[model samples]
Target: MFRPGRLQTAPNVWKRALSNFESRITRHETSSDDKKDLILTILSSTATKREARNYLSKYPLLKENDIYQSHRRILDSDVVSQTSKHDKLINDLLLKHSARSEIQLPEPPQKPEIQLSDTLRVALIRIPTPRRLDPETLRGIALTLRKLVQLGVSPVLVLDGKHQIAAGESRLLTVNDFVHQCDTLIQALQTENLQARTVRGLFEQENFSLPELLVVPLLHGIIPIIFPTTVKKDSTEVVMTPFETLKCLVSNLCGFNEAYRRNNANDLLTVEKIIYLEDLGGIPSLERFQSSHVYINLLQEYDDIISELYIGHLDSSVRDVHVQNLTEMNQLLAIQPAATGLITTPAIATLRHGTRTTNPIIYNILTDRPTISSSLPVNLKKTPQLNTTVIRRGTPLTIHLSDDQPDGKGIDLLEFDRQKVIDLNKLTHLINDSFGKTLDLEHYLNRVNGNIAAIIIAGDYEGGAIVTWESAGGRRVPYLDKFAVLRKLQGIPGIADIVFKSLLLTYSDELLWRSRKNNPVNKWYFDRSTSDYCIPNTCWRLFFSGSRVRTLDDLKGYVDVCSKIEPSFV
Candidate 1:
């Protein structure tokens, strides 16, 4: 309920009140005595109307509107003038206070004196190839000289054309001269004071030559002028002759080759190395050069490096020396022509596990090979009889309920039997109809088991369901895709595996058996070992048990019975 507009107007009202008060104070200061008395008399009148009229008459120059108008004008004018005066007054007060204060003005900084020492002079004269002297070494010598001076070692210095001493002349000669002059004048004071040391004898030495000298010192005052290499002084670029560049290239290549050999035995030679060796004029082509080779032939001297070097000396030479292209050479090594006789084909394997047996049957189908292998060992009590009837390569294998038992019932009993065969496409449709509409066909197909006798998929059976299938026969197959799918389903909370398992069980039973009398003897049957066969009570628990099934050992015992049934008969 706060009004923003009223809050904003409050500042303007306060500003007007301040301006009016300022105007009134200014009028009180400037008004004549008679005008002031008349105004005061008017204000002291009893009636409000009479007071107003009397006040206006006394200030006759001001109209009824002029009083208010002039008040504002004068206030505004005073504000501008007072602001300027206030700033000036503040500045004057600061200057006056600063003058009275005892704080001293800081002295201007003096340039440092450049005084040379004996050690530095000796070091400079000893250095050979003075122009190529290292900057770091020169700086180090300078620092050593400074330290020696601080230790009170006075030395004489020589100079060039400048009046400034080139060497340590000031410390050794000037200071000593002043001390001697002072000693003569203040002999009485010296008797009771500490004696000043004389550097006269130290400066008189003439044999200052140092052994093994290569650099000559150029003295400028007491300062030593040092000539150092360009690299030490920020800039290092040099224009090299073709021969020099070739030499550097050869040296670098030799180092690289040695490093490569030490690290790896399979180091391949590159064109750059070949060019470097060629420029050294040591070898022609190490091997016979083939014309069809697309890689740059350093021996032929037709590559970019040689071309650029040639063009560099042309009428209009290239400015940038670093420009070089080796893309063609790189491409030659990177690419290869497709080879013939490389066969490509789609191949897949399917595996299925039965109760009791740890091993299962595996079937592989492809353009090159179509076969099935069973892990049931020859020495086992029973084995699955495989249908030897060969089908053409690439033909899809089919499995379904036998036609003798129509209506999709009794299908589970004949599952292991070869009484019926339906293609993968038909089984996919059956699963879709039996499960909820949310079941994805493509996902299910991709999750089909390829490994024999291994859990293919596992998850909550309801919203997030898992279906595990293994290939027939003991064949090694990749089951990661199936496992990934099952993991995805398991991530959904609250969904249990029993829902899907029960649905599959119901579908299998309905599809396998046509009627009660049609139940096959070796067919899968639900024996109520436990009281509750409902999903949550039995099937759910069994599916979610993962590898910890309590009835697994019992299930294995029934494998012999399942094996007795003929492969073709349900």
Candidate 2:
């Protein structure tokens, strides 16, 4: 977080510095010394000129809380080609700063983007020990694994032994207990006609090397189960901690390994997902005062969340486990731009989880989306608890609220929109692309001309909102005129959630919007809305949301906007 005393320079002076930094970074004319000065200036929070404003409310007049988030957003949302000079420079610069400051950078070593030659959609699945899982849970896990295989998602299981016992057979309990567990799960998978093989690799000391021939099994459609055991210089195999093994494997798979660097590995394996089946469940939080985070943008929330967990005063063992899960999750996502990770209970991963029919692991692998949106309102969360938390290499969000101006005078959002201050063309592109229809831009302006309230945009227009003021009688309602996310970004975990979160926080008063009765996103709207109505004589369902009770005037305003609003689509 941005601390108050970090930046002593006047805010206006920093503004000039920000302009200079922004202009110079992209220009060939800029000198290296100037860029270094710009980076050092950003080490302070209050003077940050970062564009990732969604999580920070006091943006522009930045607080101390924005530094890590700003740098992370830059890294995670970088759209430049990995092989490009621009991408390399950005990565190098950020890394140099992070290392100089000894800051825990969120990304793993930047790896080459998945190659076109790679044919396998491999997932690294971390499964619980057989001793820990009941028979029913084991069966459920088998079935889920079967489905993944049928869908062409090759599963590489990371089997961990009992935490205390490092090596022995599964007879009673020991370190090598994972061997028995791995065998048991393999047997169950075979019963369902899923081919699985136990894979034990020799890790040379601390340096992580790819197990010789692990890729061969994946190529032939056989599941490879990796044991978390490493060999010392004396050649003795020691069962390392589960995450210890996972860290090594993640590095190898992401091409941060000797094998990959030598062109022997990472040719066939494109790690699509890293599924961690935790018996305890997702990272516990205090959302309503919370456990599962539903979705985590590690780039934005990791440090803050870790700090929260350490201070949460929960059970030490459970907290450690949750923290470790997030630790691996961060590395897993940092593997590549399209990398994804899931941490859910064995029950949620294997059997039915709440109202969802699809397994969380399978669901994420198939669609690259959370089973439930993270941006879902607290009241609408149907699942008893958010058992499954899906994570993705998420995009950054920039939230600009009309009511945030100081001196008691709000910025002219109306003029801003008209002047394309919010990048009207890109916002229009988002609406058009997301809705899959051509927008009558002129007509849209004519309808919401004076009603435009706020426009929230994410990324370079990956998702956005155009809300308006709807009036009836003497009352005005905040109307959600349009909420859209690019189709490509629909599966992204945090995009919709952040968009919805911004809406709720920005409009604390009763906000109203309507959707076609059959619109696919109505459920999202209805879940968050306080009350909803199926407007008579139209194919629209009117929705209202806020803490305030709906009065006759509020109702009138909501109904008028929901029922009378004109469509802006061509």
lDDT of 2 by residue, 1-570 (tens): 666665555686889878856653443222233233323323321212221232122111223212223544433443222223223433444464463334222232232121112245677888887778888888888877765654446678887555545344553344345667778888888776666777665466786543433654554456778867776777667767777777777777666333444755334456778888888888776763365777876665688789988885788888888887887788667766577788888887775322225566755654456666666566544635677777766666676654554533333544666776777777778899999999998887777764566778777888888777667667656778889989876644567787887788677666778889999777667778877988889998988777787678667666777777778888
Candidate of highest TM-score: 2
Residues 1-570, candidate 1: write the lDDT tens digits. 769998899899999988878766665343333234324433433224533543233222222112223544554443211122123423443464464333222221121212222112111111111122243433332332332222222211111111112233543353333344333323321232212121111111121111101111111112122111012123332222222222332333334334545855632111111111010111111111210111122222234334444443423322121122122222221221110000111011111111121110011110101121111121223323321211111111121222334443222322332344323333333334333233454444333322112121112111222222222133211111111222233322112222323223323221111112232311222221111112221212111111223254333322222222122111
Candidate lDDT scores, in order, read: 0.24, 0.65
lDDT, model 1: 0.24
Q: Which 10 successive residues of model 1 have the least lDDT summed?
A: 337-346
CA shift of 99, model 1, Å: 99
Q: All candidates' TM-scores?
A: 0.12, 0.67
